[model samples]
Target: MQKKSALGIMVLAILFVSVNLRPAISSIGPLLDTIRADLSLSSSEVSLLTSVPVFCMGLFAPLAVVFNKKLGLKNSIAILVAAIGLFTLLRGILPTYPVLLISAFFIGLSIAIISPLLSAMIKRNFPTRTASLIGVYSFGMGLGATLAAGLTGVFYSVAGWPIALASWGLLAIAAILLWLRVKEPVAEVSELPLEGAASVSPWKNRRAWYMLLFFGFQSALFFSVITWLAPIAIEKGMSILVAGAVLTVMSTVQIACNLSIPLLLERWPSRHLWIMVSLGFGAAGVLLLMFADMIFIWPAAICIGITLGGLFPLALLMPLDENKTADDVNSWSSMIQSGGYIISALTPFTIGLFYDRFQNHMISLSLFLGFIAILTVFAFLLNKKPESAGE
Candidate 1:
C-alpha cells in the first residue's frame, strides 16, 4: 500500500511537470497580436520571441547531465522546475521587451533540463512501464498546450496579457511543490561509470542520424503549428476568439491521440507505419489549410493535432527503444533533442521571415509542407530494431 501510494505521488508529480512544459510557448500564439500591438514589435521580432526559447531548449539540453552530476537528477529537476516558475512569472511582469526575451531564454533552459531528466527518470524507475507513463505525461503536455492556446485569449480579454501569461507560472509552482514531497527512487542513481563511459556517440551512427532527423522534422511541424495556427486562422477570416478556439480543438484532439497512440503501439509496435500515417495526416491537414475554405479549418486542425499527439511521444520513445541503459538513454536523448530542437526552432522564424516578405501565408504553408515531406522520408528511414550500447 505504501509503495503504491508513493508510485501514485510520483506519477502525479510527473504529470504536473509535463503539464507545465508547453504553455509558456503555446500561450504566445493566441496572444501574439496583443503582445505585438502593446510592444510595437514587428513580425520577425514576434517570431523571435517564439523561436528563441525553442532554440534554447536545444542549446541547453546537454547541460542536464552536468546538473545531474552536481545536484543529482532529483534536486536538479526540482531546481529547474522552480526556475521555470520564476522565469515564467517574470516573463509576464518584466517592464522591458529585452528582459522578457531573457526570461523566455531562462524558461526554455529550465524546461530543457527537466525534459530529458523526466525521460531518464521514467526509464530508471518504471522500466517496464515506459510507454504508458510516457503516454500519461504526453497527455498532460497536450492538455497544458490545449488550455493555454484555447483560453489565453479569453484570459487576455478579461485581465490583459501580462496576467494571462503570468498565470501559467502557478502551475509550475504546483509541480515544484508536489515534486518536493516525492522521495527520489534509488533506481535513479547511475550504475554505469561516470567518466569516459563506453557509450557510442550518437552522431557517428547512421541510424541515430535518421532518428535525429525524424525527431527534428516532427518537432518542426509541431512547434510551427503551435506558433502560427492561431494567426493563420485569423488570417483565414476567423475572429481571434474563434481562432483560439480552433487551436484549442486541435490541442484537445491531441490529448486524445497522445493517450491512445502508445497503447496502440503496444499491440502493433509498428513504428514506421505509425509515423508514416501521422505524417500523411499532417500533410493532408496542411494541404487542406492551403486550399480548403474556412468551413474545413476545424477538420484540418483535428488532423494536425492528431499528428502532433502521436508523433511526439513516439519520437520520444524511439530513444528508449534504441538505448539499453539509463545513462545511454540520457546521452542519446540529449543529442537527439539538442540537434532536433535547434533545427525545429528555425520553423517559426523562417515561416515568419517568409510571411514578413510576402505578407501572406502562402510561403509559410509551403515551408510547412516541405518539412512534412522531409519528415516522412526520415520517419521511414528510422530503424525499428532495438539498439544497444556500442552498436
Candidate 2:
C-alpha cells in the first residue's frame, strides 16, 4: 500500500512536469504574428525564435544524468522546475530580442533536464509500469499542447501574449511544490565518472545511432507541423478560430491515439509494426492535406495526430529498451534527443526557407513529410530485432 501511494504521487509529479513541456514553445505558433509584429521581426527570425526551446531540449538533455547524479532526482527536479518557472516568467518580461533569445535558451535547457530524467526515473522505479506510466505522461504533454493551442487565443484576448506566455510559468511553481512531497526512488548510483560517460562514445553502437536518426527525422515532421499547421490553415483561408478548432480537433484525436497505443504495444511487443504504422499514418495525412481541399482537413489532422501520438512515446521507450541502468537510458536519451532535435530545430527554418524561396507549400511540405516517412522505415528496420543491452 505504501509503495502504491508513492508510485501514485510520482506518477502525478511526472504528469505535472510533462504538462509544461510543450506549452512554453507550442503556444508561440499561434501567436507568431503578434510576437513578430510587436518585435518588428521577420518570418525567418520568428521561425528561429520558435525553434530555440527545441534546440535546448536536445543540447541540454544529455547533461541531465550528470545533474541527477550530483543533486539526486528530488533536488534536481525541484531546481529544474524552479528554473523553468523563473525563465518562463522572464520570457514574458523581456523587452528586447536578445533577452528573449537568451530566455528561450534557458527555458529549453530546463526542459531538457527534466525530459530524460523523468523517463529514467520511471524506468528505475516503475519497471513494470514504464509503458503505462509514460503513456499517461506523454498524454499530459499532448494535453499541454492542446491547451496551448486552445487557450492561447483566450489568454491573448484577456491579458495579452506576454501574460499568456507568463501564465505557463505558474505551472512550474505548482509542479515544484507538489514534487517536493514525493519520496524519491533509489536507483543504483552511477559508476561511470562524468568524463568517462562523456567519452563513452555514442558511435560505438550502430543500432543506437540508427535509432537516433529515426527519432530525429520523425521529430522534424512533428515539430514542423506543430509550428506551422495552424498558420497554414489560416493562410489557406481559414479563420483563426477555425484554425484553433482544427488544432483542438487534432489534439483530441491525438489523445485518443495516445491512450490506445500503450495497450497495443503491450499486446504486440514488436515495435517495428507500430513504427511503420506511425510513419504510414503521417505520410497519408500529409499527402491528403497536400491534395485534398478544406473538406479533408480534419481527417488529415486526425491521421497526423494518431501517428505522432504513437511515435513520440515509442521513441522514449526505445532508450529504456536498450539500457539496463538509469545512466544508460539518460545517455541514450541525450544522444537521441540531441541528434533528433538538432534535425528538428532545422525543420521549421528549413520549411520556412523553402517556402520563402518557392513561395509555395506543395512541393516543399511534401518533400519534408516524405523524407520523414522514409527515415522512419529505416529506423524501424534496425530496431526490428531486439537489440537493447538489457534485452
- Global lDDT scores for all candidate models: 0.82, 0.75
Output candidate 2 Cα RMSD: 3.5
How many residue pairs in model 2 have overlapping backbones? Answer: 0
Please list all clashing residue pairs in model 2, or write none if there are none. none
Clashes of each: 0, 0
Query: Could you tell me every candidate's TM-score relative to the true structure?
Result: 0.91, 0.86
- Residue-level lDDT tens digits of model 2 in 4-84: 888788889888888888887777777766777799976667777668888888777767778877898678878988887
| Stretches of model 1 off by over 4 angstroms after superposition | 184-200, 322-329, 383-391
